[model samples]
Target: MFDVPLMKKNGSLFAGIALLLGAFAGNARAEEMSLQQAVEIALQNNAELQAFRDEKGLREAGRIRAGLLPNPSLEVSLESGALTGNSGENAFSVGVSQEFLLAGKREKRVALAQKELEVYRWQLTDRERLLRLDAKSRFYQVLLAVRKLKLTEGAIELNRHLYQVAKERLAAGDIPELELNLVQVELARSEGARSAALEGLLASRAELSLLLGGKEVEPALPTGSLEAGGAVKQAQAELLRLAQERRPDLMALRAEAEKGSAELSLAKAEGIPNLTAGLGLKRDTTAVEVAGLEGKDTSYTVGLTLSMPIPLFDKNQPGLRESSARRDSAGNRLAAAASRVEREVAAAYASLSNAEQVLSLYFRNIMPQMEENLKLTREAYQLGEVPVLTVFEEQKKYLEVNQGYLDALYQRQLALFKLEAAAAVELTGGVQ
Candidate 1:
C-alpha cells in the first residue's frame, strides 16, 4: 500500500516538472531571432543584389560571345568575253569562292575576353556587400527608435505617478496648486514625447521593410549585455587588413582597371592584319579543237589567297592612349578609396570612445545619484521635512538619465556601423 501511494505521488511530481519546462522553452523561442538569420534572408531575397547578379550574367555572356572567330565572306562572279577568230566566237565563265580567316586573331580575342570577365565578377561582389551594409544600417535605426520610445513611455509613467501624488498633497493643504499644475504639465509633455517617438519608431520599421526585398518582416526586439555591446574593440590594423582583403568597392575598382588592361591588349592586337584564304570552282566551255558540240568540262582550282585589312589609315594609337588613361584613373581612384577608408576608421574610433565615456557617466555616476536623491526626497516629504515639489524634481532627474542612456545606445551602434562600412566587414551582431 505504501509503494502504490508513492508511485502515484511521483507521477504527479514528474508531470508538474514537465509543464514548467515546456513553458520555459516556449517563451525562449518566442523572444528573439539571431541577427545572422535576418542577414541570410535579406541576402537571398534582396532586390539590389539580384540586379547585380543579372548584370554579371550579362557581362559573362558578352565575354563568351566575344571569343568567337569572325565570320568569312563568300564571293560569286559572272563574266562574258567574245574573242573574234575569223568568224564569231564567245567564251563565258562563272565562279564562286569562299574565304576563311587564316590569322590567329581568334586566339587574341579570347585572351582579351577572359580579362573582361574578371572585372565584372569583382563588381558583382562589391554591390553585394553594399546591400548587406545598407540593410544592417536600417535595422539598427529601427532598434534605436524602439529603445527611445520605450524610454519615453517609462518617463510618462513616472510623471503620471508624481501628478497623482501632487494632487493628493494639494488636497491635504500640504502642497501648493502651482506645484500640482507643474506635475500635470510635465505629464502632458511626456505623453506628447512618447507619441512622437512612437511615430518615429514606426517610420523606421517601415523603412527597414522596404529594404528587405520590399516586404515587411517584423523582427523581435533584441536585448543584449549592454555593458560590452558598445565596445568597438577592433584594432586599426585589423580593419585595414579587412579593407584590403574583402572590401567590395575596392575590388570593383581593381576589376575596372583590369578591364582597361584587357582593352589595351585588344587595341594593340588590332594592329595585326587579318588574312583570309579562299578556294574556288569553275567551268570552261567551248574550247576550240579540243571539245565537240555539247561537250561538258569541269575544272577545280585550289589556291592560297590572302585578304588583309590595311593598317595604313589607322594605327589605333589614340585608342591605346585612351585605354592607358583609364587604367591610370582606376589606380588613382583605388588609392583615394584606401585613404578615405583609413580616415573613416579613425573617425568612427573617436566617436566610439566618446560615446563609451558618456555612457559610463550616465550608468556609473548620474543614474546612481539620481536614484538615491529620489528615495531621499520621497522619505523626507513623508516625514514633513521636504516638499512634494522636491520629490517630483528628483524623479524628473532620474527620467532624464534614462533618456540619456537610450540616446547613448543609439549613437554607439551608429558609430559601430560606420566603422563597419569603412572596414567592409560585417558587424558581429548584424549578420542577419
Candidate 2:
C-alpha cells in the first residue's frame, strides 16, 4: 500500500527544488550594471542627442553661406536695321555689373551668423544636460522598482510560511477554523500585491530601454542599495549662484539675446545705400557722312557706369523696428529664466532637507523596532503565549516599515538629481 502522507511531502520537496533552480537560472542570465554605466550608455545611443548635433551642423552650413559675397550680374543687347536696307547701321553692346555693399553690411551679416551659431552650440549643451537628468531619473526609477518587487516577494513568502503554520495548528486543534481562514486570506492578498509589483517592474524596465534608444539592450540588475545616496552638500544661495554661472539653458538664452542685438545692428546697417558699378563694350559697323570711311569699318567703344539708390522713401525702417522688438523680447526671456532657476534651486534644496530628516528617523528608530517586534512576536507564538494573528500583524508592519524606508531613500535621491540639474553642477560624489 502507498504511504499517502510521505508521497505528498516528497512532491512538495521536488516542487521547491524546481523553483530554486529556476530562480538561479534567471539570476545567471541577468547582467549587473551601475547607474554611471547606464548614463554612459544613454549618452552614446540616445536619438535626441543625435538630432541636436545634426542641427548644429546645419547651423554651421548656414554660417558659411552667410559669409559669401553676392553674385555679379551680366547684361547684353543687340540692334539691327536689316529691314530698312541699313544693314551697316548695326550695333551690339555687352556689360557686366557688380553691386558692392556699403556701411560694412557684409561684416555685420557674418557677425550675426557667428552669434547664431554660438546660440546653437549653447542649445546643444542645454539639450545634453536635460537628457542626462532624464536618464539618471529613469535609472533610479528602475532601482526603486526592483527593490519594491523584492520586498513584495519577501512579504508573500513570509505569508505563505505563516499560512502553513496556521493549517498545522488547526489540524492539531490548537487554533480555530476562523484563524486559519484569516491567514489564508492574508496569503491571497500578499500574492496579489506581488503580482502587481511584478507588473510595475516590467513597466519600469520598458521605459528604461526606450531611453537607452533601442531594443537590443541586455537585461541588467542595478548593483547598489537605495541607501547608498547622500543629501546635497551646497547651500541654496551657493546653488543659485552656480545656476546663474553654469546652467546651459541660461547660457543659451544669453547667447540668443546677444544674437538679437547683432541682428538689430545688421538691420540698421541695411539702411545705407549700396554702390553698383558697371563696365560696357560697344561695336558698331557704319559709315558716317563726315568721315570718308567704308561701311565695313568697325567702331568700338568702352563705357563705365556707377549707380546708387536714393534711399529717400524706405530705408529698412520696418526691419529695424522688428529686430529691436525681438532684442527686447530676448532680454525679457533671459530675465525670466534666471528667476525660474532661483526658484527651482530653493525648492529642491528644501525637499532634500526634508528627505534626509525622514530617512534618518527610519534608520534610527522605525526599521529596527519593527524588525525586533516581528522576531519577538514569532517567538511568543511558538511559546503558545500569542496567536498566529499576532505574528502576521508584526510581519506586515515590518514590511511596511521597510517599504517606507525605501520610499524615503528614493525621495532623497530624486531631490538631489533635481538640485544638481538646476544648479548645473555636481554637488556630491557617489551614486548621484
RMSD vs true structure, all candidates: 9.6, 7.0
Q: Please provide, for model 1 over 224-342, each residue's C-alpha lDDT reduced to its tens digit, 9 standing for 90 to 100.
A: 22233545556877877777766777777777777777777777776666566665554444334445544334354444465777889888789789888988898899889878777
RMSD of 2: 7.0
lDDT of 1 at 286: 39
Q: After superposition, how far is residue 43 of candidate 1 from its true place, in Å?
A: 1.9
> All models: lDDT?
0.63, 0.78
lDDT of 1: 0.63
Q: Candidate 1, after superposition: displacement of residue 53 in Å?
A: 1.8
Clashes of 2: 0
**Candidate achieving the largest TM-score:** 2
Candidate 2 collision pairs? none
